[model samples]
Target: MTSASRTFIDHAVSKVPAVTLGFWIIKVACTTLGETGGDWVTMSLNLGYLVGSLIFLAGFVVLVSAQIRARNFYPWLYWATIVATTTLGTTLADFFDRSLGVGYPGGVSIILLLLITSLGVWYRAEGTVSIESVASARVEWFYWTTILFSQTLGTALGDWVAGEDRGGLGLGYEMGAVIFGAALVVVGLLWLWPRVSRTALFWFAFVLTRPLGATLGDLLDKPVAQGGLEFSRLYASVLLLIFIVGCIAVLPQRAARRASAA
Candidate 1:
């Protein structure tokens, strides 16, 4: 498709899936895989966060380029980019927490600030933070940056909650997941109620899902010694990956049919 035609049809194409149950299911799966797969590459192999991050960053660049080049939304390509973000987020968050010795709270605070800044800048630049406006390159850049920050923030928050007496907030991973999940329910109710910006509500839920998934992932894989079920990280991560692939395979992920005028 011609560049002009591609841009026009983009609007008609699905910018994002509906905020339904399936979306959250896939999202948490991706997030869990992000936690374990990232650890597999970085900690298991002893590659170090810097080297692991560089690898994932390169992958992110390639996947993002492919995503942007597509004439319409391709589920594989789009979701691949998301996986890239989560993996990258994993190593990046570790870099901050370990390398900088910022601890989980410090890392979470810094990443959260950056996320807020990216959103504020994007909204100021284009007057919207809605996914529906994620067509142009400028908005796309902002979108990806915000996503990276949110994922990283999720990692930090998960660590903070699940860690033992670190910041005096030791709810453990299961409890953390429950808390975040509860918060999500409240947010959903608020969104369904009066006076919430759909755009704002969407982003709020988007950010919360990351931590929810992160904590849940840790709860499954961390050792019983560490308040988890002692399940193998690889096993849990693989299961999540299979579920994600199955969902993508069965779901109707196609973009809308193009209009003749476009």
Candidate 2:
């Protein structure tokens, strides 16, 4: 290989954690925290969705910049970025769905389109959308942008599924959780099947986890009459944050190793 090729390869280091059971556990917790934390700011604190979005968006920008600038995978930083995206996603989705009068379905459609566009452009530019391919600043930007959209889309989806009279399935939060959870199991099964692209499966599962977390969050915070436990959003967020910290402390997370030169 040429000198330039060697340099490019040498700079490549997986900036994401290995896909493992613990990774999924922490991911679900982060998404759940996103929901409760967003709600705590927007509802419990009376900041409103627009204000909440602005706050979390600022955090998202800062953390994502730090994440891209880091030399290698840092579990805390990576997950902190994820939490920012999820919380921002919650508030941004609500802003579009309710504040903008687009409703949940419209918000879902719009956010999903954005997500597809991000992934499409990323693939066209990088030739792959796999997290394993996240080895550079440019790819990292694309990955986080795609994640923001997915998180927004997930919030809209979870709310729609839980809605009682707003053209929703009226499944309630618990049922919504069940459905998303079952879908994730199917995605896991597909991962074991031959010829299924791991990249595709990873993204699919990633998207599903967001809504699952959203619904579960709602289940924890919504009123009893609304089929929820009526827990305090702040308390729920703190509990989830603790779980995430514990998982990060105990879980094995390492950057993907560089490929050997031919």
Candidate 3:
């Protein structure tokens, strides 16, 4: 085989999509959809948080199973699993924060612990938690578990910052979006310096996108009196889904280049 062909195959080995502008666009949109769609199921539909969590959890299990079983990167399936995780994260956060009376601050604290633990364990077992190292089923399991925790943490953290609690920034949705957006910009800039760890930056960007989505989603769907446009959750979710599909179709998507552990 030609060297060029070998290079292409090597890059195509990762099931996860390469970190790119298109990837971020879809990821942020998916998280936004998770917020609105979860609300649509739980609040607008009157199913409550527990039911919503169960529903999304089931979807996550099924889609993630399919994603793991697949031999190559399938953009649609990969994205579907992501949406399932974010949606599950949304409902689970609500259940813990509201139903269980843990509140946003408490929820954020707890989820962050889980996230840290997941990464620590993954790194210990695999020697690295980098996306490029995700080549085996065992590593992918670690990958998805860490993602699930991160998504949950993102939702709780986003709500904590945007909420009116005295312990948090209480910045509201618009300001919350601005804060995460600026943070993401800083991470992107840090990427330019080679000394900075790309794996670390990638995960930072990943976690940051969810809150950006949470704030943006809440800004669109919450009542006008609550500093939002009060759009119907179902309608907002549909629009976000359409945008995600359109981006996947229009933009380039390819798997990450497989490499050594960090």
Q: Per-residue alpha-carbon lDDT of model 2 for 148-173, expressed as tens digits?
A: 99898888899989887556779899
- Candidate 3: tens digits of C-alpha lDDT, residues 132-219: 7776678788888889888888888889989885356678899999999999999999999999999899889889999999899999
Candidate 2 regions off by >4 Å? 1-12, 257-262
Which digits, one per residue and each the tens of the lDDT, describe model 1 over residues 36-154? 88887887788999999999999988887777666667777777788899889988988888877887788888899999999999999988777766766667788888988889888
lDDT of 1 at 166: 39
Q: Which candidate achieves the best TM-score against the true structure?
A: 2
Q: Evaluate model 3: give its lDDT.
A: 0.88
Worst 10 residues of 3 by lDDT: 5-14
Residue 258 Cα positional deviation in candidate 2, in Å, after optimal superposition: 3.6
TM-score of each: 0.90, 0.95, 0.93
Error of 2 at 238 (Å): 0.6
Clashes of each: 0, 0, 0
**If both were scored by lDDT, which would come out higher, candidate 1 or candidate 3?**
3
Highest-scoring model, lDDT: 2
Arranged by TM-score with the best first, the candidates are 2, 3, 1
